[model samples]
Target chain A: MHSESSPLGEFDLIQRFFKAGADAMRSNDQKMIALGIGDDCALLKPAAGEEIAITSDMLVAGRHFFMNANPELLGRKALAVNLSDLAAMGAKPIGFTLSIALPKVDAAWLEAFSKGLFAIANQYSCPLIGGDTTAGPLTISITAFGSIPSGKAIRRSGAKVGDDIWASGIVGDARLALAALRHEMNLPESDLKQIEHRMHNPTPRVELGMKIREVASAALDISDGLLGDLQHILNQSQVSAEVFLDRLPKSETLQKQSEDIQNQFAASGGDDYEICFTAPIDKRDAIDQISTALNLPLTRIGSVTKTAGVLEKLSLLNKNGVLLDETKSAALLKSFDHFVK
Target chain B: MHSESSPLGEFDLIQRFFKAGADAMRSNDQKMIALGIGDDCALLKPAAGEEIAITSDMLVAGRHFFMNANPELLGRKALAVNLSDLAAMGAKPIGFTLSIALPKVDAAWLEAFSKGLFAIANQYSCPLIGGDTTAGPLTISITAFGSIPSGKAIRRSGAKVGDDIWASGIVGDARLALAALRHEMNLPESDLKQIEHRMHNPTPRVELGMKIREVASAALDISDGLLGDLQHILNQSQVSAEVFLDRLPKSETLQKQSEDIQNQFAASGGDDYEICFTAPIDKRDAIDQISTALNLPLTRIGSVTKTAGVLEKLSLLNKNGVLLDETKSAALLKSFDHFVK
Candidate 1:
């Protein structure tokens, strides 16, 4: 896939691929991006009484995806995952910076990659601003910027005791796709087609996140799996959680799996890019209306509680109110840690 | 260098190295960073009438540095290069995000790396507000944020004809150090010691950039050689330049090199985090005062000109006012493009 032409200088490559992508996808974020690519630094001018929300994420070849993964989907997923972080905080998409290390320049690959990147960027009104390009093993690092009204960002530390834990959309399909890809499981053609997009093009819940700011006391995107990601809110807010294991939201395709597989995958499916949030019990009706309005499932799966114990920041319980044993719970899910297996 | 106690998960690794670095180096940028680590997104709150400047740069192992390079200095240079981008825009550093991928967790290496990162971060009051850590071949990506008063940033497109071009500090020591390291040439131990630090630890002229904003019509930091980087200003401002090769700044150590070597390195040395700027001839005295107040050498090296031709963006001449032959000028420098040698 390497190009046969003369080596592309960094500037020419950037202008040919990324700059063209950004220019085609130029959004209404002019107030946020005062100056873009072509300068030493991009200028971000926020409106009065607003603050910028920033997050960074990195994806490495072979680790995050197969070395042969589609460049278009890879580029789309790279930016989508970062945007989901902003969605978790109820922030409006503003702009992003990309720093990529490539094995070599490939013209066709870059063309498809830029197409995917700009398609999603334009959809979310998030513009590309500034970045660095270098030569190395393949890696893509994106730092996404979003804006929120002053003092209005929903934070992971805001969950309180007695809050209801809610999750947006389905969670397990992406994990299932991974299993199939790894050859640990086999899926019928129809099933793979039904669910593979969850592993490829995740839909960042930007509008839902912005709309839920008043409802969710605390929130985070479930990129690392539901139970593990929810632990972040519990640990940050200094609260404990009791989750009803059977209540996890799952797609129709995921429901066709065995009971054990469904529960485990639904609980710990990394790359779901769904929102796991906590809110006061009083906001249940409002949340339901929001879910309906957005045509997305907002499932109530658990509740915040006083400390269960120091070793246990969160707990999984059967619908019968019996706590799952440590062995079963441990086997079911833990957040996906990049450094760990 | 691997740690045996346990595998450091993403969050733990981040908390152990980067968060600790940031906490120790916490600066008064609390006004800019409203929220820091342990959140879905870090919040940046720019004060009244101020805008944010953002830039990202990535450094990869084996490509940007040796596999066995000093961890501490590597960490320092990574952030230094990015902060220099802000300095080019005449912005005050506020905060930054780091996304790192490592082959394995080395506790000692990370400790030293974090120490070096925080040492300079604290010096500049540029706190680390957020970051992501993962496992892969070593790569470090940083997106730094700075604050500039609205409409006050020095941009690359602002250079005017007859504008005097200036460069901050000496330029070729880092390149000389690189040559020594590569064994392309040899230096005495004392000379090597004097020049090596220029490569290991570049000082981003932050305060000088802020001070020169009013005087410099256009500005950029010299990370990628002076002549090549200046081409960016000329390209943006639709101007050309005539540089006096003998007037290019060099240290006493660099002056010991052959005249041809000195001229080549000074004109096109990469990784020198000095600022190159342009201002109307009338502002020379003001720029001189800024240089004196900062106790940094500000050298007048060239002047902006109308385009000589489409292909020739900049021309270099000797003291006799004769333009250097195309072969010599071509031999001297082209911006160091990462994709090329």
Candidate 2:
């Protein structure tokens, strides 16, 4: 992006704020970046028998985040969501390209954004390679690249009948923070402080994803809530699933909420970057070993089944084994649409 | 993108307007794509001993083009500009990802846009592998991938002293049409129609770029005018160049203008997707032969030189070899910055 008052070109702005951080990330990690930054096009040389996994996401201000949301967290959230896609595919970190359109050039905002971006990029060994900056309403579009061994990528279409469903870490806390921020619900300041990070800065389940490729039959990062996003797996794999309402994992803060609120948010809350996956019933022990080894809470919350005569492919049952009614199910199925009413 | 009145979801919108085109493209071309749309991440497996070239460009409405510009032409131009980057690197287009943000979903607009997008994608055999669409100010950010033999990509940093400078096809017609469109200049409707495609749908010299890689010492796509974009090659190669005003190529429409207007635009027209390249003196015959074989014009316009005694790395000289004055040169050097007035 550019500002008339600022005496810097687009390349100068990138070099001053972002390029240094990218170079710093390179020093600490060796990746498949044959060329980074400052080229007509960056080059990547994948190792033998490796396929590059690519995914892109676009985040617009006021739609994806508050206009006044902290620039640092906004930057981190942008890349984190993309990394989660790579994680869902069971790919190893390689590099990423970011395209940002700013209303104007703000030096302080740029500095903080770069800091957040590089912090996660370094942690995951993904370096910034090539991008474009322009003048427009604030929007961040990132396309991340990762390497996966041939035939090793996990897909949402891989779920099979008689598979155990799993969820990585906790869900619902992010939506809880969002509710308080939107003034739709009230929460103590301390409670908001404890849960806000879940919404603002999500940790990609990349390591867990790569490790489970051998065990998990199907996987997807839960972005648009469990009940809504799991429908994607069901639709693609041509299977049905039943999730036990009482088995969904929750953080300590979310557990304090009312039973209705906990179940509602956990099952249908958007912005939950946790992974929901399915594995063969026989691999439950191996999946548990991976969960213990990584110290991540991988809870068995459901089971995949044949869709024969099932009313709903993704059925959310209550604590007493009663199916959620059509009206409530339809409401929760709305998910997160940018343009739908 | 979506409409409150439209029943389709995001995936449905993409599937209806884009997925079919992508599938059609895949049927005609066999590229490195291991996965196409409907997945968390697309997979590209670069063949052994080859590297991938990646570039991204963002075009914002009212900045890159007129708000009323044809949606079809706009779509074609978006992908064309990105492919030009790959062409500049002497890479062959493999695939691309498109991220679009639309204010609202208009079926007619989307149909025409997809028509233009798939036209070029299929022509170049660069299938649409993955992307994201959302609701926001209309913005299209594209990241293209291309394949190049390892260690063979052309770079702006490769020009050496005494290299011959060349420009592909004509250079100023795009800006000539832009001047008419902006009402900064007057032109007959016939002339406007003739030159409008130069501005709206400039072709990428992918074939010529791939052919001349063996001869070109340095290469870059001229997007922000030849005089302005050439400075990048000079700067990166730490060299100087001289361009003869009489040698600059102009379309018949641009040639019919006043000498001052012709020279001014030919040297400094923006949105020109032509390539400006440098090659060793002996490689002139090789380049000329490739030009003849491809039936494309490759005009020799200048020469690269050492910067030890040259005040300007990129000097524009008149017919008698007189250097242009600083005042005029500075005026032509603005080079289309998005945020600057």
Q: Highest DockQ: which candidate?
A: 1
Estimate, for each residue in A87-200, the C-alpha lDDT of model 1 and write its tens digit.
Answer: 999999998999999888888988888788887888888989989999999999999999999999999999998999999989999999999889889888899899999999
- Clash pairs detected, candidate 2: none
RMSD of each: 2.6, 2.2
**Candidate 1 runs further than 4 Å off:** A1-7, A27-29, A308-312, B1-7, B27-29, B307-312
Over 4 Å off, model 2: A1-6, A309-312, B1-6, B309-312
The DockQ scores of all candidates, in the order shown, are 0.63, 0.62
TM-score of each: 0.97, 0.97
lDDT of 1 by residue, B1-341 (tens): 01222466666778888887777765464677889877989999889999899999999998888899899998888889889999999999998998999998788999888888887888889989997888999999999999999999999999999999999999989999999999999889899998899999999889988998888999999988998888888878988889999998899999999998899899988889999999999998888889888999999999988865553378899988899998788766577878875
Pairs with backbone N, CA or C atoms under 3 Å apart (clashes), candidate 1: none
Worst 10 residues of 2 chain A by lDDT: A1-10
